[model samples]
Target: MFCFQCEQTAHVNGQAGCASTKGVCGKDETTADLQDLLIYQLKGIGQLSERLRALGKPDQAADSFTLYALFTTLTNVNFNRAVFTGLIAEAARIRDRLRDALAAAGGDVSGLSAAVSFQPATDLPGLLAQANIASVRAGLDLVGEDVIGLRALILYGLKGVAAYAHHAEVLGEARDEIYAGVAHALAFLATDPDDINALLAEALALGRLNFTVMEVLDAANTGRFGAPVPTQVLTTPVAGKAILVSGHDLRDLHNILEATKDKGINVYTHGEMLPAHGYPKLHAYPHLVGNYGTAWQNQQQEFAAFPGPIVMTSNCLIEPQPAYRNRIFTAGPVGWPGIRHIQNDDYAQVIQAAQAMPGFAEAAPAKTIQVGFARETVLGAAETVINAVKSGDIRHFFLIGGCDGAAPGRNYYTDFADHAPKDTMLLTLGCGKYRFNMHDHGEVAGLPRLLDVGQCNDTYSAIQIATALANAFGCGVNDLPLTLVVSWFEQKAAAVLLTLLALGVRNVRLGPSLPAFLTPTLLNVLVEKFGVQPITTAEADIQAALTRQAA
Candidate 1:
């Protein structure tokens, strides 16, 4: 499989891969092929969405269908064979309907990719059997690295869009434009792999559309959850049966909390799920417990040591160690070859898994970990934070955000955090914070300089805070006394970077490394248009950013 959807792609040109047969992320040849097919189908649907929109007939079902399909394809979401096939079949039907409609409308779309036309039986298990046995693989050996990288980038962005769209749909909110954009993006990746300039343009376009999608998701989350507040979540799991829920789906967390309520089970957040504590609806669950582990890469050790069952809601799930294999359950899009998966969206199976596993045993509760700084909470503190800036108490604002990974170069984030100016306040979100969350960066005038604004979804908080500060200071966001130093490892981070670019946030530094997916021409466009840079030494980069701001 020639995959380069992440920063961790095997080669810079994208021709290299994690593994020739199976993915480094535990994905086998079959899964990778299925993911490609799913992307293909979604692109078809995207073409349909645009056609419908042109005809003044935006389809909610089409939008939802694309969202669900994309969500299923995201990293670590769906591994369950049966669940994936069902979604693919559903997407196929939708694609067929749209293709027929487009054809009737005299839209000569006969050259569409085979992904749109592929059919799967409605029977979930049957489809799974076919996919599992068919031995489908990416024909990447025939393509150059740059083409592979660009397509991977496109696919990853669509996955992120799918996730945001799913969150919006959860809250009864939908954006047809965003859905159409994602679908169109997928189609572009499938057909135009060789167009370097076109790929770069699409990457930027993905970024722009993602920004819109994220804003919609932000509204849905904050509106439904009553905004995030500053609160510390305990890491200790209380005594009793417990289930560790990881990944980014807050709605699933709430549902689990509801299911486990009064059932003597404790729930703890892990990885991206740690931000769940900031949500009023989620944190209100007394037995919701605390965070179980750090970022996604540490799951092997963390899950191994855990005392109970675990449920994954989204990406960053590694293959389970044998020690904890029996106790892990896949929910939503996350699936593993051998893991038990919850079906029918009922989540009853997850609850049952928690009951069967050893429940949480009594453990000592520790100091609270501070969280909750979404748009509302940060806005509430605007007066104080602003006043501090005005009084010279807060010297600099450093937005250190992006994805977390296991690569050695990732230590750059930890070192950067360690070396940042003492007076500089760190506003971070996403798994990227995994680098420095354990470090003690002493307070700055009674406030913790290293402030976490929840998960990647909460990156909106950082954006809002920047915009608000700029408005308060009567300047554009770029002119505000803030710097964006990002660390990206995957597609969601790419989406976030695009959002920053779309908003005209300039002089942003991204690392532990630049994405292998970007062609030289594509990279040049971003550098010229946005002044985005790859990270160098922390000291030098920080000094340069500050000097530029001072000038």
Candidate 2:
């Protein structure tokens, strides 16, 4: 039950992973073992799906299952052992069905590997027995830590890709290429390549794959919700019955809004859902109130104090505390052991909970925060931005974004954003912005100095904006007066980092700490090849980024 895929892995006496009875995220050994077994079966499904694709007989259901299954394995997404055990069995069933179909189609399956031929145990003890062999570091003695670390990097990156793709798929947006890419990557892991160089290259390949997933998601979101527009969201609580939707799933929020509309209940966005207020279609809902809290890490405290029911739509859910466990709901791939989960997107139970509970009795004073500066909204005023740069009115562009966590040294990001020059524009995305989004950075040349560019998956929007700025300035993205200071917390952030490196984007700073899975040798390789640097102090990093322009 060794897991080090997130920023908060157990680090004791020079140890770097969560191999004890319970993970730092509250995932116990049994749940972790079940998750490993499920992932192992998913790899088998991936192998079969890849083979089926080669025969020109790809199964859409298998593809969707693979994506959702990988997403559930992400940090803080799902901790329900029963849910994982069922999925493991389903994966084996899909693999066997696909194998039979291939044989019926005259494709030879006799030479296929054991991953395609082996059967999974039906009981918990038997499954745990098989998990030791299926674990991520199964052959660590032979392949060594470097190879194992690189493999974990690739696998974690793919998990992030699957999460973003899953969000898009539920919104009626998916690509066969993405499905194929996911299957190929998962199957690649099944073979356990020991070559460090090859494994590193595959990590970059997963990065490029994540870029495609992010693009599909960007289109799906904007196409369905309309491009994000600049809007001021009220932060103060309103006097009414309410339901708070958290995590990154816009579809869930949209459906909940529809269900609770005109029902005397107000819906507010929390965590990464804060950006939903920027979407024109979602913003049109009158009862869709405002953002309730900061990032996912603070949910234990925030959810406890909130006066209504809460719904976690996707990843980054911590263990639900007893105070709010019964009232909080899980949707999509998100789950906890005993918490109520919303299947089929039905919100009747959640609505009832909100109706049954005491909501805000009196309206708090209105306080506003600006959001929705996605690519479209920013590019609509690109000429103004470009003109400011040309006239020396804008000194620099700083992309201070990524996932946030409870770890130390994260305060560097808050200080970095707050300390940036008044003439500089700070472009932010992901839940990390919660650290300083409320801090007033003022404006520059008629534009808000701080730009909130949607969620973490909306790194696509950040890329688009950067590319446009580069094109207008007649320079490469790196040559622009922009610096990427990314604060990573989980696999999704890892995938985004790989995307930046794969695209040859250089001099990006990543912190609060680098992934524990990355060995010192692998870290050196990243530093030398990609110009990736571990973040120092906010004052030093800000000065270094600004000084680069002078050179």
Candidate 3:
């Protein structure tokens, strides 16, 4: 098994990807093969779903399941081999279901490839034997590195798209086009086309598709919880029986809050869930106290120290350490073999565990940080922002954010944010902000020098703010006085980058290192075509952005 669909993939002798028994994410070869098989099966399901849709007999249930199944394959989301084994069978059943409908609808399924024709095995060894059907690195010698790299990018982007769509879907949002787009892209993958130009177009199309998915997710979030407002979140803990909610699922956090209400339990947000505090409906829960930890990578130490139960709601989970493994709970797509999982939004076990353990022993003073500078809050102050720029009070903007990792060079983001000019505003989101978010940036023209846009899930908010500012300044988004310094770790970041490229937003400096899946040739194409460049030094990149602004 070979897997390099993330920023943290193993590098052996300068060759990227983890081809050993285990991946850098701790996903063993068995798990990796199962994920590959699940994706392969999803491709078949998608092929049939696409064909059925074209015949005007779309399967909505299969579409929803497709989104959820694709999401489970995302990096750090699921590592349970049993879960993957089950999903493989479920995917096959769904594919067959779609095929039956297509057959009835007179949609020809003849002459299709194995992805659409092969049967899944009943046992683990049998399934593993068929892993070749969905090998990520197969035929690299024939198709070459660039083609394989492009295909991985598209497939990973689909994972990100599915994750976002699934979150929104669970929050009561759905679109037929989403189903069609996902199915179409998956079907496209099944053909294994090596045409570079066609593959690039499909990648960009997936990016555009993600833009709509992001919109639906944004609407789902704001509609259910009200638009995020700028609010101060306390970083210190309070005295009570406590439960820490991590990852990006607000729905899980909300349910935890409700179940623990008046039960002597205080809920704290961690990782990407930090932005949940800014939502009116969620913040209204007084028991939902401050944040407990910094980012996902720090969870081993943090979770070990936390006294109460910890619930992981979505992605960004690392292998649970023995110190806190028993106390930790996985929900939604999150899973670890022996760890208890909370299903169906039921928080009884979580609440009971929180009640059973010791929480924070003492209440600390509110050490607050500003959050929720989303599209609404940012655009509401557009007049002030515009005036600040016109009056030379704000020189530029730097969006220094994305998933943070334990890798060495992550300091680039912190340094980039720290070394940014005082006149420039720093816009951040996701766990990457934890690097320098606590720094006092002072105020630029009555606005804080740093603004927290939100979680990575709220990337739509960042894009919206950029578009609004561009429109206000009467220029293309590329022409705006802004720089995007993105630190990506997983597939969601891949999707975000694709969305930016598809929107034609240029000069995004991505680091801590380029994706291993990207062969040098593919990286060159991105650099030449999209102005994508790897991060150099903070001071140097900062000077470069300023120079571009001056020119």
Candidate 4:
């Protein structure tokens, strides 16, 4: 159980990784090993599926399975071993079917690696037995740390891509090109390439692929929910039977809202779902109440105190404590060992749980928070923003966005946003904004000082807004008075960072700690090539960004 794919991995002496019996996220050794086995089998499916696609016989089931399976392996998404067991067997079956299809199509399949040809174990013991060789560290002695690190980067980025693509797929949006790119990237990792240069190129390629996935996701979200508009959401509780929906899946939230409509349940957004309030269709629900909590890391306490059922729709779920475990339900790719899972968009069980629990006794004092400042919303006011910048009323723009974690260093983002000068505009996205989104940033030149672009995947929106701003000023994006201060926690943030680098977007500050997988040499390469800087104190970084803009 060697897992170092997240920011909060345990650091022992000079080494960084979660090699103990349980990970920092509460994932046990058994679950971690099962996840590895699932990924290994999925890579086999990827190899066969890529070949099958090349033969003009693409399997939609294989493509969908790869997305869902890869999504489950992301940080804080799923911890149920039984779920992985089923996925492993299914992946093996899919791989065999694809192999047969490829062979029948006259595609040569004999030279494929063991990942495409190996048989999956039938039971738990056999699966555990196969894990040692299938794990990420299998060839560490021969390939070395730098090669292993690069492969992990590409693989982790692909996992992030799969998560975003799955969100888009559930919304009835998917591109064959994105699917093929995901499969090809997974299959490439299976070959265990040792060339550092080739691996780095592949990582950047994944960044480009992830950009497409995010674009598709943006389309799916806006197409289904309508473009986000600036709206004020209540932060206080509403009186009624209530259910809290967390995670990043708008489709699941939509389904839950539909199922619970007029049924007396007041739905409240939690975590990344906070941004859903800005969407016209979602906000139209009369019973869709205000946001209920902060970021995912605070779930244990928040969920325990809430007097209603809670439904997690995607990643960033910690192991449920017993206090609220029975009332908690997992949906989509999220799962816990004993927590009830909502399948096929059927949230009947969740509704039943909500009905059984005592909701808010009475409406808490109404308070509001503003959301829905995505690219369209921001660009709609482009003239005002441009004028403000030109008149020097808005001196700079700071983009403080990314995934949030429990680490103390994350407070730097809060302080940075809170302390930004009144003349500058603060832009935020992702769950990281939970740290300071609630804080008042006062207006700068008639516009809200703090603007939320959207979810982590909506880094696409941030990119678009920056590009638009650059075009408005007739300068490159890097030449604008915009700075990106990213707080990374998981693979999704890693993929976003890679995209920024791939696009030649420079002078970005990344932190809450660097990825444990990146060796010193690789880190140096990023520092030199992309001008990526480790975050300093909030005051120091803010001053530095302002200094760079002035220069």
Candidate 5:
């Protein structure tokens, strides 16, 4: 159907839709349509919040509910039919109430109401049935060349907010404003606007709000997990039956570790889960063995040959092949129709799956990957880090965070890491670190040139580290000798970027390409306000970023 929710939309401006039988990402047509509907319904729920708030009933605002709902609709969170259906039904009820409220207010809100309308045309076929397929293609069509960029930017920002809000809810942390604000903004974006300037302004506000939501999520994570500490994680799979856990869900990782503790089954982190090694609470699980696989896009080949069962806790789930289908379990929001998905948020099914599958009985890894640069560990070494900076031993801090993909261009990350100067330090989080995490770049002073700061969600750790450095330097975050070079492939990355923007962190570099959703106006706003730029050649980008610091 007409889906442009990700950076990998078909190249054609108007006509390139996901294949009807299969998606570019291996998602079948049904899943793609459902994702579209999920977003549409979330918009409805968001519209309802606007109504409740306008009625001086701000207390009635259901932020947690809206945020969770939107989060569920994010790229790779939930995929269970039952769960998806229930949420859709709930959203429908909320949408109906919103329609009634706006109608009764005697206010002409048709424009805002369009997104949530419970009409057949909202279904998948109806959407794809448009005679001109070009109309549904991403970029240069939906919002027009002029405004498409802006709309995409705001939409992506909202998606980021929804992700952070989602994580916050997982930890029992609720912020009504984030939920309501995101929903209201989504509803507004869906509105048929006659004033382009007004839309652009709101879009900018969405970026700002996304930042605030990310900070809240950061606090929630650190508060619950304890500030991440510096620890070493192994990449070599250990002996005995092993289970590989991927995606960005720490809670899921915790549950799996708890379920398999001393059960003769060892657990390993993959993709964004690699950062789990930093949390004392999580690392305490002795059997939580090292990581496996390189990055998200390499899953098919990696997972196929792995000698253990694999569990996905979040995004970047490649649809499994028959060769490894039985050995895999999808948990949390990641779902593929034929795949065995965890029925509940619980880990019982995952445990059972691991038990039934053939797993590793090999020896411990030859070497382990280092981790644990979270706030506390880094701050604890604050004096050492500060001194190093002062001595010019650690000349630059490169914050390389974001998702990993199989695109040829993704090789830029590896090259950049390989080329980082001897005195420069690379602080990496998220699966993107796969490019160079496995490589030993030697050390800067006593510290490893590359520090694995945990998973994508652990962007919190990066922020904490940056803030501490800024405070020590008596300057804003940007003024600190740090740079952010991020690679995004999903909504979670979107949230992290928004958080950076919200905090007014400038001069960040994003690559391999900008999202297809952003309209030109929105892109300009981000470039103008945040100084965000696309990544160039690894050499050029690194030199430019480093040169800026020397300036």
Candidate 6:
């Protein structure tokens, strides 16, 4: 049960990984083993799927399932061992189905590895025994740590890619390129190659695929919900029967809003869902109230204190606190052992729970923050931004966002955003914005200095904004007065980081700590090739970005 896919992974004796009975994120040993087994089987499914595709018999269902199964393995998304067990069996079924399809197409499967040809046991005990051989540790003894880390990077990056692609698929957007890419990567992992250069190139390939996944997601989001606009969202609670929808799933939130409409229930967003207020179609519901809490790490306290039911729409769900355990419901791939699960866009259970419980008794003091400065909104004011830069009213831009965690070093982002010069604009997204989005950076040239560019899911939007500004100024992104300060907690951030690197966008300041999955050797390679930097002090990095000439 060795895992280091997230920022908060445990450390012992200068090692960075979680290998105990339980992980830092509350992932128990059984669950961790099951996740590994799931990945192993997914690789098998991917092997079969890739071959089936090569034979001109691609199965969209199998391809989509591979993405979704990978997504469920992401940190903080699912911890129910039973769910993983079921997924493992389902993976076996899918693998066999694909195998049969390949055979029907007259493709040879004689020389496949155990990952492609192994059988799954029907019971948990038997499955755990099967999983023991497939744990991440299997490669450490063979390929060594450096090669193992390289493989983990590609595998985790693929998981992140699948997450974005899955989100886009939910929104009725998907491409064969993304599906095929996932299968190919999965199949690549199945072979367990030890070639360092090949693994590095594959990781970059995953990044390129993620870029397309993010674009499809961008189009899906804007196509369905329209581009976000600058709207002032009340951070204060509105007194009413309430349901707080967390995670980054807009489709789930929209459905909950539709079902709870006129039901005397107000819907508030938590975590990454805070940006939902910026979308026109979503915010049109008057009952869709303000954001209820901060980032995902605070959910225990926040979820318990919130006066009504809670719905987790996607990843970043922690184990439910006893106080709010029964009232919290899981939707999409998010899960906990006892939490009631919502299926097929159903909101009846969540709505009933909200109505059955006492909501906010009194309105909180009125406080508001503006959001929805996604690429379109920011670019709509392109001339103003350009003039501000030319007139020296705007000296620089900071993209200070990513996954937020409860780790100690996280306050750096808050301080960095707060201390940015008034002449500069800060573009923020993801839950990391919770650290300083509330801080008043004031406005520059009729635009807020602190721009909320939607959620981490909108990394594409952030990239687009930077690229547009670069085009306007006639320079590459790295040659612009823009810097990326990121805090990553899970695989989604990993995928985004890879996208930035693959785009040759260099000098990204990543913390609260370097990824455990990145051996120093691999990190040095990135440093040499991409100039990726571990974050220093907020003051120091800020000064460097402001004064350093862009390369």
lDDT of each: 0.76, 0.91, 0.91, 0.91, 0.72, 0.89
Extract clashing residue pairs from model 4.
Answer: none
Candidate 1 Cα RMSD (Å): 3.6
- Candidate 2 residues 35-110, lDDT tens each? 9888877777777788889899999999999989999999999999999889988988888899898888887665
lDDT of 1 by residue, 1-551 (tens): 44556765565353545546766666666566666556656766776677667777667788887777777766656665555566677777788888777777777676766556667656644454445322212444666656666667667776777787787787777777776787678667656467767876787788888877778888888777777878788866677887889988777787788878798788899999887788888788899778888999889999998877788888888888999998888876678877887765677766777778777666775856778877677777788888888888887888888889887788878888899888788888998887898688888756778788888877766777888888999999888878898888776777787777767888899888777667676577678988988889888888887898789
In Å, residue 501's CA in model 1 sits off its true spot by 1.8
- Which stretches of model 4 miss by more than 4 angstroms? none
Q: In the order shown, what is each candidate's alpha-carbon RMSD?
A: 3.6, 1.0, 0.9, 0.9, 3.5, 1.1
Q: Taking the tens digit of each residue's C-alpha lDDT, what string does model 6 give over 439-536? A: 77898877889999998889999999899999999999998888899888889988998899889999999898888878889889988999998999
TM-scores for every candidate against the unseen true structure: 0.90, 0.99, 0.99, 0.99, 0.88, 0.98
Candidate 5 lDDT by residue in tens digits, 1-551 = 55556666666556444555555665555555555565666666676667667765443344655666666656555555455556656666767776677667664565555556754244445543422322223434444655654555566667667766677778777666776688678667555443668766776577667666666776777677776777777788766777888877777788788778778888888777777777778888899768787788888888888877888877777768887888788875567666777765667766776777668666753887788777677778788889999999999988888888766588899898888888899988888888888787898778678877777766766787898889998988988888898998877787677667767889988889777666566678779977989899999988998898889
Colliding pairs, model 6: none
Which candidate, 1 or 5, has the higher TM-score? 1
- 89 Cα displacement, candidate 1 (Å): 3.8
Model 3 earns a TM-score of 0.99
Please give me the total number of clashing residue pairs in predicted model 3: 0
Cα error of candidate 6 at position 122, Å: 1.6
Model 2 whole-model lDDT (C-alpha atoms): 0.91
Which portions of model 3 show Cα errors greater than 4 Å?
none
Residue 478 shift from truth in candidate 4, angstroms: 0.7
Which candidate, 3 or 6, has the higher lDDT? 3
Better of 1 and 3 by lDDT: 3
Candidate 4 lDDT over residue span 1-551, tens digit each = 99999998899999999998999988999999989988887777878888888888889989999999999999999999999999888888888888888888999787577888778778898888888877887799998999989998888888899999999999999999998998899889888889988998998988898889899999999999999999999999988899999999999899999999889999999999999999999999999989999999999999999989999999999989999988999998999998898878888888898999889999978899999999989999999999999999999999999989998789898899988999999999999999999888889899999998888978889999999999999999999999999999998888888788888899999998999999999899999989999999999999998898888
Q: Report RMSD for candidate 3.
A: 0.9
Rate residue 530 of model 6 by lDDT: 93
